[model samples]
Target: MKSPIAIRRGAVAAVFIDLQEEHRQDQRYLVDGYEKILANVQRLQAAARASGVPLHHWAYIVDLGAQDRPFHPVEADGKSAFSDKDDPLTAICHEVAPADGEALRIKAEASAFRSGPAAGELKARGIEWLVVAGVWTEACIDATVRDAVASGFRVLLVKDACGSGSAAMHQTAILNLANRLYGGAVTDTDGACRLLSGESVTVWQVEGSVPLRFTYENAARLYAEL
Candidate 1:
């Protein structure tokens, strides 16, 4: 593992993905420990704002009229099983809603960078790192983190600030991403907040090939550490 590095506030931005009502209010998509995840995200958001880091919010909004992707889940009334753009449930959860002057990027795909000027804008502003948090650790969070690294941004993945359908799903996804997160590190919300505040903190980063060496037998032990 690499030593902890300081993340300057000016070079870092906070990216929050899909903290919408659909995940918390709808049973079909509710993540495990949804409330705790939101609280952590809120703490990170506050830290970012206080420390002069830019905040970017991404929300998943599916347009029912658009061509359905393979295996798109839908209700009997033709509405999206997730966050349909027209449904009230698509709203960003009030607890973590974007404040005034913070624009919310609405995306139809899993990766937030796929449809927005976020990558370009952040680069133009000289952003070198992204502190990422939010939902569906195995889906949207994983996709966004991968794209962020591919776009030349180092990521500080706030693990506890992210959630999925279950603890196992979330931990497994983190393990998979951490194994290959070349320029990123995995830290919980507290460490993320400290880093965002320009504090150097030791975080879990990929070191050698197969650092985790995850297997079915050791999965529980690894998840506990994360």
Candidate 2:
């Protein structure tokens, strides 16, 4: 079968489920961080879009059958609390609505390729590289990286574009994954863009990872209408 093509600005996204009132006060809230999560993802989407990056090409992993979860979901304050109106990751995918020619993957598990159509879709598209960005970095991100690498795809984890239950969790996840899974291929949203397109990198570079200590200040202005 064919595989996903090699593209710097390929299918990427803030792969997470929408948080509803039920999401919190329950185990799900642990992964849903209300406005913080949405804001961060929106920023990521806007940044990617301004860069002439195709939102449709950005594959968002949603839990269509998530009666249960095996990942992390946190609040904006870095709290692992659920919320109300948690949007399904697929809604974001449909938001872009890729052309029939493009491909998208639906998953019910933490890892995008752990147990769903991601593997097959990726294979058929011959996807050699994936610029992954999303929330709950510790759980879903970790699992996705493990699976993607095992399946033979170069994984570029977008640090800033992803978050976790807390700062500690986020940082720890980045360190572990970069060292263990990606061998230091981890980068922030800006760094990911620079690496992918070799243009302007807005986020600070700390050992080639996110949680940046520096930022391009003019990053937004750099690509005002990108």
Candidate 3:
């Protein structure tokens, strides 16, 4: 296989999913390697903007009051601890907040396309491939990647730019994505940047080692020592 999967400028879009402030505040949902993920996301977005590739953001929003009849079927009413209206919580993390002209898609589930026009919008914009990054590697990231592939959009998942509550889950999700689910190449932020710049990187096939510096196990150990 080629080093990193090559993505042409016009055919690919950079997507950041569910990196909301709420997730950051909640230690349980905050994935390990969050700091690195945020930094990488910012780097990826900057590269995307400079290269003229479209940038898109997905935010999960739920209404707590309507527990009996929530706006989104999967989001049971009163189940969501935070609503999108919680400005601080719902706001995209400051490190990677969308800039002017970038579009934000509001979703109520793990898959952004399920409750929003993400699929249609991307199709309309002529996006043939996606470079996906963001929080909760095992949940939202996984869902969005699968959905994107199923919708006929090729995807290159940014491995280092996403995280999960635990290292095990994060690794598992990426393995499933590269091996079973999307069957696409996985790259880190730098790899994505190079690909977007029409360069090549080591094609990251699933392996035994984890490349991230601050893994969930490490983080848990450090926190316990605190």
Candidate 4:
């Protein structure tokens, strides 16, 4: 079996996914206590910028003119979610907006890599570790993290910086990722900031609001016997 990839500061990128304005302003679409999530994301972004780490932002956008497709529940309801390109709904939230040179990618699917250039772009920039934060923890964030692992990139999921409407779902996703389904790690805002600043840190997992660090001592002992 292939061992997990270690996340080093130099090759990591801070990636903010689908932090759209509409999701923040509208309670119907917003995750509960999203303001706090936004704050953490902003902090991570600032830290990343100061550390000279590359930042990438992603937005969820639907093609308004596409035809011959099955109706999504939102479309069947005659409500457009992020369909209009010029609308502020589709724009990244101002609090954590993309900087002058940061790339902002728009995607119609849950995973940013499904149809966009995010995967290739990161590889081209020599980024092998992804520090990911964004909204809807069980949806886009989950999809992105899984695909990132499948596509050969190590992921560090920002636990406190991601928001989801359902708290249970959010926790479930975090546990799933940290359990090594995709060999991804989870960290809070402070840990991510520290990592961005070139500190070698153990990636932590959030379990019911408590942070736990991963260790190999038990496995190391077993291997030593062999």
- Local accuracy by lDDT, each model: 0.88, 0.49, 0.73, 0.73
Ranking of candidates on TM-score, top first:
1, 4, 3, 2
Q: Which residues of candidate 3, in runs, are more than 4 Å off?
A: 1-4, 66-79, 82-84, 181-183, 205-226
TM per candidate comes to 0.95, 0.54, 0.80, 0.81
Model 4 TM-score on a 0 to 1 scale: 0.81
The whole-model C-alpha lDDT of candidate 4 against the native structure comes to 0.73
CA shift at 168, candidate 2, in angstroms? 1.1
Local accuracy of candidate 3 as per-residue lDDT tens digits, 1-226: 2344566668888889988877768654566877888999988998888898888898877755543444433324435545445545788888898899887877767886655577887888788878899878878888888888888887888877888887677776675566543345676677789888777666654333433234545744422221
Write candidate 1's Cα lDDT for 51-148 as tens digits. 97889999898886885676789889977787887889888899899988899998888998865788999999999999999889999999999999
Shift in Å, residue 216, candidate 2: 29
lDDT over C-alpha atoms for residue 97 of model 4 = 90
Candidate 4 residue-wise lDDT, 74-143, digit = tens: 5454555444454667788889999898878777778877656778878887888889999788889888
Summing lDDT over every window of 10 consecutive residues in candidate 4, give the lowest-scoring window: 217-226
lDDT of 2: 0.49
- Model 1 residue 46 lDDT? 96
Clashes of 2: 30
TM-score-wise, the better of 2 and 4 is: 4
Please report the TM-score between candidate 3 and the true structure. 0.80
Q: Look at candidate 4 and tell me the lDDT of residue 206.
A: 28
Name model 4 segments beyond 4 Å from true.
1-9, 75-87, 205-226
